[model samples]
Target chain A: MKKSSGDNWDSLEKNWREKLDSHKEEVPAAIWNQIEKKLDEKKGKAVPFIIHRRQWSWAAVLLISFGVGWWQLSNPNALVDDSKMANHIQTEINAPVQHLPNTSTPELEEISSSTNPNVVSHSEPMPSHDIHSNLNQEPRNTTESIPVIEESKPNTNPVILADNRTFEKEKPASLAKEESVEMLIDIQPSQANNQEKENSYVPEPSKKRHSLFARVVKQLRQAIDGEPVDWQTLKQGDPKLENSIHQVANTYIKTEQVVQRTFQF
Target chain B: MSKTLLPFKSEQELIQACQKQDRRAQQIVYQVNAGKMMAVCKRYLGVGPDAEDALMEGFMKVFSKIDNFQGQGSFEGWIRKIMVNESLMKIRKTANRYDQDINETYDIAHPEDAIMHLGVEEIQNLILELPPGYRTIFNLYAIEGYSHIEIGDMLQISEGTSKSQLSRARQLLQSKLKELQA
Candidate 1:
């Protein structure tokens, strides 16, 4: 076998390269069709990417807004304000009931309390039967009852009376003044007896159990009202209330820690 | 039709229009270069629909990667290189499908003057008669003017293998040319 030298191949390559240079064949028109179709396919793919990006941006915005709303609702300070409002209402309702125990003739006290303090002190004292007659007329004029109490309190400290009137006005219109007066009359002694029994009982567990039940009821009511409940406010009353508040606070703290851990992911 | 009347006389303007994806500019560019690019594809692939497929794919690559052509070399040369690479890829795929090696040697007597009498189409037919691997290396080394080392690197073979393949390809072509001349 003979091996060809590089020069022999170089000359052969030169002839082929020159001959092939002028050899141009027309490209089939079908190739352009295929190319155009492929280009269209690529364009189709690009459009969906843009649409998906826009969709993702909208989803991100919605998620951020929902997170902010959840944060606002879960804030503890909003619950504190609701608890304070509940405490104020409780105090006002208890005031009239507390004064009930001091009077023997309840009808006289009701009639006299409704009048001006100066008028009650200065005018001739009304008979017990006449006070009962006034009480019978009281139910007929429920709307005028609150205004009469306001007008009769002129001799008292006006600022305190004005605050009371504003508080009274803030109460729901569905709770009639006459109904409240009747409720006060009915519950006064029972409330007094309950207070005495609560103070006399030295047994810690029974008292604690009772207060815990009351705190749970109150917290559930606050939760229903879309408010945050403050377990700290429940700490001021009974030893049981304090214990229950501490237990609730510990549970809340643990739950919050769990939430924080979950959110970290 | 009115848009087609616009002048894109220079290669720079045409490339810029192609970069901007002007269809008319791309079509004009395709029409101008397709003939020569097809010729380059046919050299490796021979006269077949496979060469046409390679030409379309090569042009598509040219239009897509037109931004990469930095005007350092001739535009036609860059396009020709892409066509050659596309042909090599197609050849590689075909070689894999058949699973044949170019190490099978052919015995032929060298006919020095016979090739000169053969037409270009006859010469192309003779080259296509060689096996895929030999045809690829021969086209790269002889017509495309690549060295044995470059061909070795491109095909992942040793330089010695490329040289041996090219030798066999030349001998086969010489014999085929001698037959045509007779």
Candidate 2:
């Protein structure tokens, strides 16, 4: 007998082959229509692409960005009024000029006096002798140190307390440290009432205010800023008037001899 | 209207049409040899969507590389090799070629013992159902007669891995067929 395509040779492969062969033979008209349509569609738009200066992908990128940017700009919340921002800046620009330590308090005299211990700590007898010897120096001059003594009617005002609290925040280190240290440095023992001292004591009136630092700060500010514009000259437009009057006669001294030779007999 | 419009009616015609950039000639070349190329593609791609991919892919190779056809051997055979190689290259892209030994130490009571009970259909179905990685290797080595090195080089796998994967595919395919027959 011939060597058969035997049953032992696996009918599974044989049947698979048959199935596929049949499928090839009998592709349905519908399937063929789909295939044809696919081919036709591919060829339908087969216009040989003509490219100019730009890349195709670049055009795609531009299209996407423009669409996105257009949508973003058209949104209602995208715009902001700049005038409001300007007004905010203007308000900040015109904010009040507040001096920190000028706040009022019942202890104002004592506080001002205590700010400088050097003047108040000088022996009173020495100051009396100097005042007597200095005949040219007036006792009541505006820059002289004045002495103040408190009378016995003490009052507690809420406004005074509030102002003291505000200015106390800016106290110098010696004033802010132990009350004993402050007392030891400059206090006259006669005014020490151990009874009233149990309560908070503001600086005593025998202290003298320090104006030297403030005077120096004023001078530095003037140096940096230059003298404030002279309002009278500015108003009159008279920049040269001072020089013209002061030097006119002096400038003609050299020319006088030449003028005499040319025009005098 | 032109006689060459039929595209690749003969090899001479194909060469002539190819020189003219005839799209129809390309199409005809594809249609004529698709079945044979598909057989080659099947050995490389195995049975699946990948085979379809390999089919289109090999056609492109056949067309693009047709210029290299020196008409040395049967052009159809040359064409078959290109399609086969194209399928393998695609498979190479998708598959790991390193030979994995599913049963390097296979204690398979016996390989024949597993397949003897099954009808051919059950076994072929088992093969069809195999994981793509194993099926591609099995088909390339057993049915298509590719050497292990050729399979490895074509699929980018080591020869040892290719041999091991085939052995495993056979064992697994046989075992599945056994289970089905019962």
Candidate 3:
């Protein structure tokens, strides 16, 4: 038996090592040819493993980033920054409110004036608190079909409105009559109601009660017509009220009955 | 026409070109290491298509993974390790075919003078004559310089089996040496 440490065993390993260290057989040319072909095939097929691994990592990172961005967009209010939210609320509070003219239909004016013809009808601009101005702008062009007084002829008979009220052509010379001036009628509801209101008017409470009813009716009209009540014109009468009332009405009021109820007070 | 006319002056330059996947540099790398790697493969598997396959596969790995070589060791040593691993993989499938009983002993003769006189080809032939299991253990122990414990980890066998296989391989090789001398 050959002991592992025996000289013969040691010599056997040593000789094999010394001889084979310098001994190299010739590799066949076909092997290199095959290897070259395989390298080419591999090059054509894919990138190196390191680059492949890098690309996958980048793809994963991009996918995660996109997922986070999509989540943020889908739930926009969930991550509102406190400072930005405060800035937005402050801006809204400081912004001035805008409004449109509170205009009413000529039909309501004709009814009031015909019932109380002795009520003086003038072309002067109506007051902001004028009950007729409490109604929203009438259904657009409801007054266009109404005949307007001719500015050229001062002596012409007052144009008869839908309510049979005469629209007097008296004018202040400085006020220019615009072709599309919106009309506002000032007429007593009826001789009896006007007398009663004049007698029992308790200035503050009566005016407040009347305004509250007008506001409620305006809201209902707005709800039904899908139009906002032009409260600015309610606070400040139509800026162009001094001009001609002959211009075709621009805005709409859907319910004539609502307009009638609004000013009946 | 010869496809490879190597312009790289140093091994580092060749390795860099291979990292860049230059075909001529790859060919030069294959040409330079193929013969020694084939000899290493043959020591384990003998001269056959299996050795050729191992040689081709080892070079393929070298080119594809060239970027991993960070100048830590000799390039040839790294390649030799790859070739050895490829051979071991080819051997693992048929490992059960030649597993003899450890108790089956051979009377090892004193063939020190004969082993000393043998040429490289004769020593290689002697190792090839061993059973596949014995041949693997002997080549790992003798030529590759792996300890039996390392061999056990590599081949997934017990240290005792590695030692027994190596001892049996040496006894059989010594008997062959004595017969050759006669």
Candidate 4:
């Protein structure tokens, strides 16, 4: 009888396994040498690629650090010291209200520019409207001759804080009242200085109430003329001043809207 | 100026040394396995640079991954599997040659006597003459003792395809054995 299927296949498989598995062919010795050289090459290539990636990572980190440092330095208020800012606000609240000197618009510009070097004078075209007629009557200052308001601190050189962009929000109500009072004092000099007649005479405070309204009006006019405004005080002040302030503010807004519409066309 | 080399005390010690990338241990391991691995490569790739290349690549893998061996089964078995896989990879690179159809067929019968009479190289040469697909399937199934399922997985073919290729290989080998016997 023929052997079972399993037995027959097993014998054949067994015979081949015995012959081939035990068999050993001679391997050229040079093949091992080739393997060693290739392994070395792979190690050589791998090390540098990892180091190169690490170097790139370090470079990226340093570049980002340098960029952040440069940005903070260029932006003056980026590293604002809270204590110094509080001190500046305190100084503005306590500072005495000085009278505007008897001087011309050019003289005011000269005084402002002489007082603060950080102030950048930029003369934007003022919109022609009834609201700004008072400002229009005055001689327009050239781009280089316009005055920027600076932080009026004693002893230290006055620096243009309003132009720093954070001045309006951080400025207290007392500071706004003082700036409005001081602006009126500055503008009244042109008319009052003529009464003085002597160029050498210094200006003194007049017991005049109309100068307050003029101060508020001129502040609104200055805002419409592209100077920065302390809108915080105007919006959030005592309700008693709101009516007069809002009426003038509305006129300024309407004039600005008309100007924008004119420019769009 | 050369340094003296010491032989490993035992197989475990030898494996540990190879794991540490000891050059002497690596050379000794290569010397022991190279002949058997070369034989396995020649069976799949035949006697040429392809066979030699597979042998070199296989040994390199064995050394590189020696730490992973973990004393699992026989070390020689582990190395032989690597050599076989390396040869298969070389076959796959040529791809077209490895899947060719051997159209000729013969009856399924035992050639136990002829296999017994033939020398090792003669039987090897006979297996080598089969098409790459047939040869690979035959070596994997008959000599390597792999199931048709295992062969299919190894060569990325279906079990049925592996069976058919193995059948064709056996028929061709039997015919060749008869021709030699005649």
Candidate 5:
């Protein structure tokens, strides 16, 4: 199967000779015009897309962050919306002690004040509206700067803390799909008694008529389609097959095999 | 003349303009390659209209992948390879035409006599006139001079089929020419 180098070179030379031979036709002028039109159409369609893709990702990121901020403003359980929580964490990193939750609104506010910036950055970005839009036009707000006001300390990872914590027992009365945090907590108790087992996520397909019919249809259709077909396939002894004949009936029949008497010409 | 690729306008200016999404550059590239790509595409398609479709698709691929052209290799060669690939891919989608692993030896003795008898235009036209499956294999094997092994691998057929197809293509061409002579 291994070819000699000389043979390969000879092959290349032969190909070139053939290519020269094949390109001898003068293409009609009209066809060439049509080809140009096609190219123009393609270039036109793609030009906008090239620019759009290049710019859209940044816009998408900003919009998502903005959406999160709006969602937080109305929601009481702000931490359930991870994006807004992360944005708040980033904004609050340098926030004054006055803004930090005091004895009045204590636990979360104290946690916010103490949380490390490194941990804050890793969580989802808050739905912060274009609060920082002016940063671009201004000389510098320096979001990237991470100002050296606070001394660097060994920061514990928040995700690890979140994963390790034991979730509170779900009170059946408080269980609601509308509250994501409650639903998450609700789902956890099931993992123990496992009311809905792991496979519950993809529920067992019920033997409903619609579902069974679709699966049967799909299998039958697939079985009949695409593979090689033999010329002679026949089912036995049905009346349809008993009457089925390949040859044309010499006499025309109104509905059956026999033709009725014809009228005089 | 070859060095002055753009001559009055310069191909580099046009290519750069194309990079900037210029209409004029798009027009120039289309105008320059349409005829040749059509001929290439026609070799791999069932009919002229399908060939045109392949031609359009190929040119689109050419423009998109133009950045990958290293400039060390022949520009037309690079573009031609892309166009050929596009045409072949299009052909595969429609039909799995490789029938019976063609296991026959070709009596190809350099085809010198036929080459001498036929003009380049005649030969090119003859190749374009071939049926899609045969024309494609012929072009890849004879003109591209790909080994039967390479042609088989590329077309998803056995080496024997590639060999037989090339021989069949050559035989078809010779017969067509003989008919014209008669």
Candidate 6:
């Protein structure tokens, strides 16, 4: 048996190429069905323009957050700053009052003398005595006159109850009484009315402060209990009020610490 | 005659319609070329469902990448190339297990009458009977007219390896022809 040479292999290769090149087979009809089915499957897979499930979830979350933010902005109940309301009332009280054209200076003097014997008796002409006498005599007229005094010298009308108490507490006994009387004279009728209304609505200031401290403690407890507080929403209003609340919170914390130390002792 | 007389779209028109994803035009293109493409796939994959799988995959690729055909070559050549590539890929994946070393020096007995009597189907079956490695190189080099260099690049074998494989394939086929004659 002879081994084929390279030339013989070339001839065989040529013959093989000619044979295979001329050959044509019918593709099975079922192949087209398979291909069409595959194409259809591919098309089905590709056609869905739906966002990913996670992306859709994220979009829904964002939409919900925006809706909640918008609702919070629109809701009047959401704007519950007690201190802002108090400041607004004080501003109204401190505003200048228009005196009636018919009420002359002589009439004012006569009214002052008749209604307020204390004012006439006070020879030194103390502003506090004049105001106190007028308050005692006629509440309506006192309301009108106080704004006049406020307009004349605004700082002299120092009617902040907290300030008076702190000032008296820190001062000598004699100076404390005089300063306390002066501070009382500074209380405009409108401010007194507002304070009364607030007092009626909530508890007295001491009780309210205690309740606030209790609420803060409860919030701290809840936070320790693993509930999250949205401090961002709580700190939305006036900076001054935020500062005062922060101070009160610190004071309450200090008082709690002192009590804790006393108990330990 | 009547089918020929019926208005048939030019190859360009069919291609354009296929690009637009027109199903009718795509079907028409498939009908025209699928037999030849199947034959090409059958050469590499042999006569079976594997050939059908390769053909189907090839056609799908054709449709998917129809935009890449820049009207430079004959559409049939473009389609034929895709079918060939698909067949090669399928063979590479399935044929890795059959990577036996080639026997270079086989005894050759020329059986001209037997070789001549064998129909194209018999020859194809004989080619399929060759080891997958030999069959692939044989198809690429001899039948497909790819240079040994091209076959090497396509199959990732060296050029000398492709030449040796082709020789081994021819010897195997000749021996098969002699056996059929005997």
In candidate 1, which residue pairs clash? A208-A240
Model 5, B1-182: lDDT tens per residue?
Answer: 33434432676666667666565566667667666666777666744667767766677666666677666666667767887888888888988877758688556333333445465566667777887778888788766667888888888889888878766777777677667767
- How do the residues B1-182 of candidate 1 rate in per-residue lDDT, one tens digit apiece? 22333577577888898898788888887877788788888878888888998998898899889989899888788999999999988888776522333555555454576666668877677777898888888888888889989987888787777877887888877766666667
lDDT tens digits by residue: candidate 5, A1-265:
8665335435544654655634622455665466567667876887887676535544543344344334433443332233334434544553342211121133332343344222222233322232233223344221122211111222422221111111112213232222233223333443524543431223222333234224333433343354442212321222221111111111112212211122111
DockQ of 3: 0.34
Q: Estimate, for each residue in A110-223, the C-alpha lDDT of model 3 and write its tens digit.
A: 444565442223343334344233234353232332333334334533332222222223222232222112222222246435544554323233443245335434543464
Instruction: List model 2 lDDT by residue over B1-182, tens digit each.
Output: 23433633467777567556566766655555666565555544556667666666565556556778777877666776776677766756775544454436233323333444554344445666777678777666665557889977777777877867866675676577567657
Local accuracy of candidate 1 as per-residue lDDT tens digits, A207-265: 44455445655664475356997766676654433543454445444554554454444
TM-score of chain A of each: 0.25, 0.15, 0.21, 0.27, 0.21, 0.23
Ten contiguous residues minimizing lDDT sum, candidate 3 chain B: B97-106
The docking category that best describes candidate 3 is acceptable
Report the lDDT of model 6 for residue A236.
45
Per-residue lDDT of B7 in model 3: 83
Model 1, CA-based lDDT: 0.63
lDDT, ranked from best to worst: 4, 1, 6, 3, 5, 2
* Weakest ten-residue segment in model 1 chain A by summed lDDT: A157-166
Q: List the RMSD of every prediction in angstroms.
A: 21.7, 28.2, 25.1, 22.5, 27.5, 19.8
- Poorest 10 consecutive residues by lDDT, candidate 3 chain A: A242-251
DockQ per candidate, 2 decimals = 0.28, 0.04, 0.34, 0.40, 0.12, 0.31
Error of 3 at A189 (Å): 42
With a 3 Å backbone cut-off (N, CA, C), the pairs that clash in candidate 4 are: A100-A185
Which candidate achieves the best TM-score against the true structure? 4
lDDT of each: 0.63, 0.47, 0.61, 0.64, 0.51, 0.63
What 10-residue stretch in candidate 5 chain B is worst by lDDT?
Answer: B108-117
Q: Which ten residues in a row have the lowest lDDT in candidate 6 chain A?
A: A157-166
Q: Global CA lDDT of candidate 3, please?
A: 0.61
Steric overlap count per candidate: 1, 12, 10, 1, 11, 0
Tell me how far the alpha carbon of residue A216 in candidate 3 is from the true structure, in angstroms, after superposition.
41
RMSD score of candidate 5 (Å):
27.5
